[model samples]
Target chain A: MRRENTRIFEKETTGSFMNKEFIAINALLTVEQAILYLRENVRDKRNIYYVYIINEHDRLIGALSIRELLSKDSNRLVSEVKVSKIIFFKTDIDQEEAVKVFRDTDLVSIPVVNENGKLIGVVHVEDILDVMQQEATEDFHRMAPVSQKLDGGLIESTIGALYRKRIVWLIILVFINVFSGAGIAHFQDVIEANIALVFFLPLLVDSGGNAGSQSSTLVIRAMATGDIHLKDWFRMFTKEVVLSMAMGFTMALAVSAVGLMRGGVTIAIVVSITMVCIVVVGSLVGMSLPFIFRRLKLDPATASAPLITSICDITGVLIYFGIANKLLNL
Target chain B: MRRENTRIFEKETTGSFMNKEFIAINALLTVEQAILYLRENVRDKRNIYYVYIINEHDRLIGALSIRELLSKDSNRLVSEVKVSKIIFFKTDIDQEEAVKVFRDTDLVSIPVVNENGKLIGVVHVEDILDVMQQEATEDFHRMAPVSQKLDGGLIESTIGALYRKRIVWLIILVFINVFSGAGIAHFQDVIEANIALVFFLPLLVDSGGNAGSQSSTLVIRAMATGDIHLKDWFRMFTKEVVLSMAMGFTMALAVSAVGLMRGGVTIAIVVSITMVCIVVVGSLVGMSLPFIFRRLKLDPATASAPLITSICDITGVLIYFGIANKLLNL
Candidate 1:
């Protein structure tokens, strides 16, 4: 299955799926002659949406749709019948980029060219549809809760295989959580003095984790859709900062009443302030980590939910207790 | 944009994007006559890959490719040339289902018919590709960490609008974490007696949250890709139970060593047992949630990562304390 994963990856080149049987006619041929040639020579005839017009050097100069060919004068040369404004992909380009081209162009078929600008193969729209589906599946898999390994197909994976895939992330999270433990250990005296502080631990930390996850997922998704580029990082970060502030203010107001009921005024103040700080910091960290990854040329999706949570777990504990220690004077 | 969303939704009907300019001819028409009619009447000549043969009642009976029409004897009737086994969709059917049909059959254009089997429209392959991209985007948005409101497009949304979308989930989570607080409160006496127990609280609960998140995501993705169905619930649950047991046992062994160093053998035993139980229960709960949502006709994706984490948090705390109280004589 692992080898199969490699095979799939290798097979993603544009040349691998390109249709070699595509109609390529000499530009000098008449529309009548081109149609006659297509009628005689178009084998592997499924999804033949367009005919490529090639010059004397066999370089693709233009493309003619069946409609355009049929609508034109029968004696017109293929170059006269063809549309010169066409998009083409090199054979070595990734299939994902090819799918993007198909989507952006809204064309039914695109020609695949070699380095010399000669038409080598054609990628049909149906192939692009398959590529789109595969890309979506990969994104979903990559963004999984703990991000299991990409061992061939996801759903059909064996139990042991799936366990092996998921446990790696969990183990990393567990180790990262040791820092969370250390933070708790450092604040033990305060916790011993005010045991009620322990009651709000999960609330404060999990909220931060949730907040961070929301911000990171938004950034990652925006990146995935090409809506947010590296150039937009500053704007994205600024937006997150403002959004988190508004969110934090709202949350502080909402949770302060509960905090008051749980403890005294000092505890309420401690918790409220900690909540605001955690929310703001969580969102900023979430928004920033992806940009850092992108800067390093790593996948931004690698900054996953659990990864964000583990990070926030450690920082969230530090913030809560640091605030409590000062405000409660424990 | 809200109106645009509605328009897109309304446009998902099979008839919405269907091309009415499809070439349909009587079976008695010769290939020459069919081609002549197509040249004269086929207004949308861009993607004319197939020609349909219909009976006198306008019921679609067969289909022929352009290659077949061009290569065949010009004197032959359309019926003699067309393939009889054709797949078609009803006009009112959702476009998602039509996309599925395109994927499964790998057909370029599918005819949309009325209830009486009369051809009404033809759905082009290009439209299906567009639908696939849109559907993928919608799924990603729906399964977001804290799903934003469908105000318009997701990434293009305003900061305030995105904050409004996200805060609902956080506020609800805060309320839910209050249950977690109550769980911790219920076990306050035990925690005060054994402060070591407090150190392991995040570790145990977060492990469960992580495990639960993994299960729910896998199930949700499987459901999205059409790999899992309602009937597979029993099998899916059984698989999860076995997988979680393997996962739990492995995690228990690894963490028990750390537990022994933190506490004593009794505390270690308690934490280890609780870890195993929580892992199993967490995974089972996560696996069950999406199925339950699906059974209720709600989106299975609504059982989101944070929602699963919150659910596991309360239950995980209870389980850890429940086990610790009995074993450590708290």
Candidate 2:
């Protein structure tokens, strides 16, 4: 249900990932009978871990791992040999959820059931491994916003594909950078009045962006790994705010000396305050954007470092100049 | 061997990850005898897929899946049922290599052997899944330079730990930004004459960092997944140059219009040339830092997004000012 809203996951449900070949034995067969039946039928099925059991209507009944089945009394009925609690997936569960399931149960494969509880197919750990890698890589790309996956390795990918993959985001970021330019432009008077203010521009702004990048990275990965949920946003935000304040003070203490050496006490004050405010604002935006994207049913990694940095650059400019404009009293 | 150089991986070799409990049947047993042995001993053992076959010396000789074993004739010797070639790991192989081996072989668990080929223990698919997630997350943190992972997620991590994790990088970045400050300080006269240059500074510098971030992320993730290697460096660098030039032109085209609107034809030319040059420099630096780190027996992921951006920002400042100073003749 949670995955239905995300477009990338819609098609890869457990129904689509079933192993075509699996042994589904009847519930009536004794261990001895099933072994005899399977010896004739189960030739060369690649790594069969679990053999499913079915009742008269062919509905799912129980399950037995080959390991358990082998270590049982041959005269015991399939009912006596099978596992009591079957862990299974409905046809609609996404591969990500399937990966989570396999992790919990330690079963290499699980049965997938249809609407009427009939076993349609089995999903294996091999597929789960692939999904784990795919989901992680997809999220990696989005966080990097490498934007699209290069199906092959980087060396194997065509130059055009590389160019196309990277250019759009760079261009979009240039557009976003316009606001930073505009923020600087709006404070032309303050900038001209104290040209020394210009010295700390990149230093201060880049710190904000860097802090924001860290915040977004933390929140995005936490969400991706299911370590934190959507309901945890407010708690996360509060933690980020407190975390950023302590970080801002540390950065301010380090940056103030540079500000003082460049432009004296007033300039140091402006840069330090701007540093604190920008770090807080930048970090808050960085941490919050991913949560917003997830709520919109989008990949939270869409709040990439470049995207976060570009945005923080805008806020960084405004905060720096806004602080400078007031303090300089021009 | 690829892992011995990196300190983080040295402790996590397959020797450290071997499962404590596994079934190792002797090569001399008949199928019926082994079954009777297992039936008594294997109750409640979780997800036993492969019962490895060993020789008189306890050396790994072959492996038999329980599924395959059951389908054999009861009177057949274990030699008749066990696979001819076994898939296993040396006790010293790293977990990442273990992960790759599991991916290539469909077995849920692979046995580990000592230098003498004596059976030590088995490694399971469950652990592979954990490593897959952990490796991806570690590289993700390194790329994000989240610096260190918050083991219990963001909400549970202390403000002090969060501050400590994020602050060092931000402080180091502040020092790196000094080059940008010095570059601007060196060009103070040029700015006094043509102050419009300051408006384009954040926008232009960020584009370089953004482009660099993309390039580094590509190389880093590609390396993590084994899609590319250290040997591909020269070829990748050449491709990056070509890729950067094309991207530079595209960005130059986009940024020049704003350049023209703001500061006339002369400023536009300076901005365009600087844009092209900065992207190329940023792209080259980002592409190579990882390779350099790898060669030094460190994590290539140490070439992080924030690190790339800070270095790019420094180069961005110098290049943009050098071009503007020559062209403006101030």
Candidate 3:
């Protein structure tokens, strides 16, 4: 049976990629036939990295690199000098996981195997790098909240694809802004009376959004890397609370100083007090929302910087007006 | 010199855990000394995985793993067998980049270095993970447009802090909303005449913001990983365009079907065309903004999902109204 297989192997090599093809040698092949066949027919023997020794059923038993083969006695059978122990990837495994393994092991290439343990293909390190780059790009895009498949293609083609992915979300956010507009218009009397409030309003919202974004980015990134597990919600919440307090106090002192410098006592008090309250609430909300999304088994990234910022925009307005109504007798 | 170092090392490990002072090791010792010290004196070597092999000047020369010692020939000289290949992090390197390397390598610990190659401190992978988790949470909060720090303590103590972070941004966004309101108010005559248009406004803005966020996320993530360099701006922009077109057309078709179901033919045509154009533009803007920020050496993450979304919200409204004004002949 092994002899018959060797005869078939010789016939198949006649049509394959001459420099890249592998020649399977049965353990029974005489040393003379193996050397002659390699020397005469295989013109690119130097390029062939390994000569696999196989069993009668075509199972890989051992391998010999070309250098190893030449170092041995020329008369020795290929199987006599073969080295054991091979690492390979199974076909059923995920490509992403396979890429990770490729990176971790620093293997030049990995052999692919079918479910039955038969050799299928080879995954090169270069290919894994390409995959990693593509996946990282896709993750970044996903974080942005656009959806699209990533693949190798022309720049023009990719841009056209990107445009389609982005537009729908923009429309939704725009319309959402109308609600925010309604929130503002509802407070028209407040704005008219405290026109100074209008001046600080943009600064407040932009800062609040920035702060909230900082929290969400941190949380989402943590969740992505598996550093903070779902079970650590309480611990995370506790940590966020403490961090927010320190941050809020520090920011309030700064903002209050700025307000005092620019807007006098009443405005300073109002801005400082409001600044402290809004930042604390925003930080907690930003940190917790991603956890909530993750608990729901949704993509935590969907609880993104922009979504949180918009939510804060609406909430900040309500809080500002509510606080002002009580404190400033509005 | 080695004998003198060994005599000094023997004098340092003499106390119990409760009474023991943690004396920092300043110089590299032999593998036998490392093993003996760790085995008898160091109670919690779980956190410190390797012994740093340093030169006399405290320059990191190599590392010796405890596990490697356990498996290797125990009688061999430490210098002869210690692994010389060392991967380390410089102190001035950005924490973000450090986190990525930590995640990718999955090392138990990494040595930190200064500009002159002097050893600073060992950044245990666990500590890096802690920092990463905290940062991620903070980013999440900032993304929400909140201004406070959110990770370090109890919620009760931090509530005030949360308020500070959240309120300022909310106030600013509230005022910013006025501009959006003004935009809508400018078109009040148009909206009142076509009340149906008002109903679709929210959906459009939301979709546009979402689309923009998707693009921003992808671009930002690509930037983070060093996959998309500043030089690849043209490629990134072109890809965004292609992706946007494909996504925009698909969404337009879907929205058109919805419009036809709700409104008459004119409304359907207006909404569909507006949807495609707004989404396409939103995606392009979202994709490009991060790269622009990166070019400016500003953090691409600062452009964020919420910032992009909010900006897209305003743009989407303008586009929707502009298209409606022209197409509806209002």
Q: What would the TM-score be for candidate 1 when compared with the true structure?
A: 0.92
> CAPRI verdict on model 3?
incorrect
Work out the TM-score per prediction.
0.92, 0.94, 0.54
Consecutive 10-residue window with the lowest summed lDDT within model 1 chain B: B1-10
In model 2 chain B, the worst 10-residue window by lDDT is B1-10
Model 3: per-residue Cα lDDT over B134-209, one tens digit each: 5544544444554666544422334465456555654455445445545664555555555556446545665666
Q: TM-score: which is higher, 1 or 2?
A: 2
Q: Against the correct fold, how does model 2 do in TM-score? A: 0.94
Every model's DockQ = 0.55, 0.68, 0.13
Give lDDT: candidate 3, residue A306: 56
> How far out, in Å, is residue A85 in model 1?
3.0
TM-score of chain A of each: 0.91, 0.92, 0.71
Best by DockQ: 2
In candidate 2, which residue pairs get closer than 3 Å at backbone N, Cα or C atoms, i.e. clash? none
- Stretches of model 1 off by over 4 angstroms after superposition: A1-9, A146-156, B1-11, B19-21, B41-45, B55-59, B116-118, B148-155
What value does the lDDT take at residue B3 in candidate 2? 38
Evaluated at residue B154, the lDDT of candidate 3 is 27
The candidate that achieves the highest TM-score relative to the unseen native structure:
2
Q: Taking chain A of candidate 3, what TM-score results?
A: 0.71
Q: Provide the DockQ value for model 2.
A: 0.68
Give lDDT tens digits, candidate 3, residues A1-330.
Answer: 233223222221211101224556676665555544544545432223345566777676776543344345556766776676867665455554654465445243455544455444445443444455454555455555555654443232444454455555554555455455566556656555554554355445545555666677666766665557788778767777776666656666766755666557877788777776777787778788888998898978887765776776667666665676676664
- Candidate with more favorable, higher TM-score: 1 or 3: 1
